[model samples]
Target: MNKKLIILLSGLISVGIYMFLPADKNVLKGLAILFFIAALWITEALPITVTALLVPIVAVMTGIFDVREALSYFAHPIIFLFLGGFGLAAALHKYNLDELFAGFIMKTAGSKMIFSVIGLFIATALISMWISNTATTAIMLPVALGLISKIKERNHTTEVFILLGVAFSANIGGIGTIIGSPPNAITAANLGLSFSEWLSIGIPFMLILFPIMVIVLYVILKPKFPDMAAIYTIKTQDVFCNKKSYAVVSIFGFTIILWLLSKPISTWLGIEKGFDSIIAVFAIVLLVLFRTIKWKEIENFADWGVLLLFGGGLVLSGILSETGASVYLAKLVETHLVNYGPFLLVLGAVTLMIFLTEVASNTASAAILVPIFLVLGQEIGHFPPYELALTVGIAASCAFMLPVATPPNALVFGTERIKLKEMMKVGFVLNIICALVISVVAYLIF
Candidate 1:
């Protein structure tokens, strides 16, 4: 059978099965919507964004959600938070701030293998924390490329491993805060927690995880470029010769500060609720108006498919919520699992999130799981709902194994130096380590 025909037939069969299930029709419809989403994600037939928009459209057409309710997710605060961050990232990229920063860090490390690893980890982590992981990899990849190009070795495998480390480091670093990853944003929005609250939890988690990740990477993949003295001879002046653009740096810095201080600022100013995204949007507008960023530059920035993926996931999640499918699923889990303590609950949630995220978009994983976990949290009564919610959020960002696992992995895979098996070899272990650590810490802290 032709691929398209097979996909269509499979979708129809899934939807047909759902239609006959002894459950709410809306629940059946929501499942059908989810099936289509999964097919689109796996096949990559359409842009993920287009696939994302399709969920709400399909849900509305199927009478699962009205048009207004279906489309409202596009205006969701989390979506805007992504948009605002993307806009700031665009401004920084245009000015080449990330490259300059990464170069400066590499230069300062002076080529000790351990120090180089630590510096690379810190730079990649900080950048990923603020920008999207994809962007962080794109910006830092060149620096890695530069380092590799200068150092010649008979066996290139070590270079490949280090480059892969850079990419994977971006993924690990993004786990530190709500804005650090799309799933984190989705989890926070679903639970009605403020961005600041999520960050308070995330920052500490990152502090603990960062060093552990560095040690693991070093032990698993030994550095091949061991001539620290020779590597240091490469001029820092050449790498960071492009002077920093103050205008761009100031604007980007201010935007982050504003996002971080949004709650305090809103409270002191007595603004109504939900002003973080508004402030973010406003900051982007001001940047454009003041020519801090040229409109053309903004237009030329990379189109992030995650946004559409997020939107589509939101629509599907909304349908699930509106139709009470999520509630129903949550009840089933609650009946069987509520007797488990908070630690087990956190572990279960994180494990499910990591496994699902490998197959689906991280945002989609969060969308499907957050509502169910929220219900489970209420029923379990040992820990607050936010704790479980945060675990799902962090787990969503923990996709380290496959190219399809996360955008950062895919971005690095394009370089062709790192083999899929190699990634799996390292990522499989990291996944287990991350899930265990996140669950244990989350239960303790929250």
Candidate 2:
């Protein structure tokens, strides 16, 4: 469908709902806004962030919230946390720490193809834990290409496996931390999940998935290197150049320490907890105060649209929850689901999220669906709302079925080493496994 036509139809459908739906004035308005945004999100009629910007405008026009109230979601503390994360990532890129990490890891793998692929997965996932998945993929692509070129007899499976590993590893690595992906931050902010809290689940989730990913790809692709002895190598000494690089690494390590230990540290000092946002801000300050990075450098790396999209999602969430629109929707769907057990309920929600994200922006998908899932959690009463929402957050990143599923996927596909059919064949298998894994883990843990 034409993007313009999809957008036009979305607007008209929303209007029809507002005018004809039998509901409270505010509920009707909220539903209208929800459908409009969801349609645009599913079809991508506009940039997801642009559609996010519309949420507040529509809300104000419908009298659901005043300008001040509607816009406030954009400044939510988690947004600042994300902003700080972006700053930290910018500094890492500015100083070339990302490349150093990649080189150092891949260089340690020796000449074995299997070991090299594992190394790439490890490096991408580790870096992606702190940075955006797209940046992580970008950092690793050249390393993979360098490795591939060194072999005189390049095996097709080897090239495809390594390239797919970069993108898939980037996505899986993001499951390790709140700042690693937008969906994690959005769901965390909404559910009031602390950094450490997320780490407890996120890290374990990543750990479990990593080996599965390596095993699955290796077994399926059956990659073989005919000339492993000819693989390229990097000097470890080149990984760290000078005192400035060391300084950036020190600051980066220090920031991560603060995030992990913030809770106990707060308890010991009799300070409040949930200060990860403040820690994030402090990391940015250290970068500037120490002259490791500059304001101009940050402009090139920061992703302001994601921050705005998160805020807009929060706005819509508040309107839905406060105006009873979410409850209304949940009630309408509850009967059909009432007989299902808790495990089945969570499984269904997680599965839906995995598939939904295969087409829509995972971040946007999380923004739209997490709130609704939260309300559905309330209606079901089998589990906490946050637990269900957390599943959605984690599952949102499990999209592996299409090139458009994630930036990393598209990034790898652009290399032209892997076919669309190859990606779909492999991605479809992983998608099913991930859905099942997420569902089971969430049900047991929560």
Candidate 3:
């Protein structure tokens, strides 16, 4: 059958099931909403943003939520977090800070083969943690290509391995905090945790995972090069083009200071409301006012499509909660798996997130899973639900295997140097390692 017919039939069948189900009508309605989200994600039948906007609109029209309340999801803190964060990244990019930093690191670490790869990976990861993974990948790909080109000219065997490391690190680094990836932020907001708290948890996890990842890449790839002394002797000026570098550095430095002080500023203002998003937005406004970025830059900064996806997911998840579908599904899972405890819950949620992200958008995966996990948390009552929910969020960003898995992976894949199987070989192992680490660390800490 044609795709449109399939989507129509699927929606009709879901609505029919909701209407006829022997359980609560609300539960059935919730299931229908979730099914709609999944079908949209799978089919790409409409623009993701339109689909997202439609979610809450449909929810209200179908009696799932009050119109005002449904529309409020558009202004949700998580949505603003994305807007402001992207804005900040755009400002930095306009000044060319990301490229400068990447080049500086490479220039500094060029003396050692192992340290150069490590530094490049760390820099890429740190950049991805703040910027959109796609933008980060785009910015870094040229530098990685440059390094590969130099190495290839010299007939070095290690160039390909280092290139792969750069690509993989970008994906892994985004797991470090809420702003690190869209899914992380969505999950954090859904759990009602402060952005700062999410960062505190995420930073340490990233720190721990970074070394493990570097070691794994080194061991698996076993890159080799000869006469490193000559490679290390290149002049810094030749490698580090100073194109708008200082402006990028200054803006980036200020942005970090502002992010670090956001919580304290909120406390000082004595505001208990939407403080994190407020701080982020304030930073962007200030940057624009200072001419660090232009109004046109701000327009290009925001990912309107992703923002809509987030809104739609929120509406769908909210409906699931309001309609009692989440609770019912939680009860079913609890009956079978509550005995497994928080460890298994964490593992299961993370695994599901990783797999779902490979096929569907990470933001959609988080939205689908968060409400159900929240319900499951309440049902079990033995361990914190937020831990599992957070794991799912972080893990959702762990899509490293395919071009569709993440933008960064796709960006690097386009270079044509890294094959699908090679990406998967590294990504699959990294996914398992990250899942295990997140599950253990989250359970222990939270």
Clashes of each: 1, 0, 0
Model 1, residue pairs in steric clash: 52-312
Point out the worst 10-residue segment of candidate 3 by lDDT: 227-236
**Full-model lDDT for every candidate:** 0.74, 0.85, 0.75
Candidate 3, residue 123: how far the Cα is off, in Å: 0.7
> How would you encode candidate 2's per-residue C-alpha lDDT over 140-230 as one tens digit per residue?
8988888788767768988989899889999999999999999998899788888998999999999988888877788888888763653
**RMSD, candidate 1, Å:** 2.9
Give the Cα error of residue 309 in candidate 1, in Å: 2.4
TM-score of 3: 0.91
Best by lDDT: 2
What does each candidate score in C-alpha RMSD?
Answer: 2.9, 1.8, 2.9
Query: Which lDDT tens digits does candidate 1 get at residues 1-446?
Result: 46577568758876785878788776776666666666776555665667787788787788877889888888888777777777777877766677667656765876665466557667898888878888898878876766666665534666756677787778877877666788877777777666677778778888877777666666787666656432433343653454435666667777767767888998999975677778778767877876767767765663556766777777767777877777777778878877776688789889888877877778767766776777667666787866776688788887778889888889888998888888888778888888999998887777
- Residue range with the least summed lDDT across 10 consecutive positions in model 1: 228-237
lDDT of 3: 0.75
Candidate 2 has an lDDT of 0.85
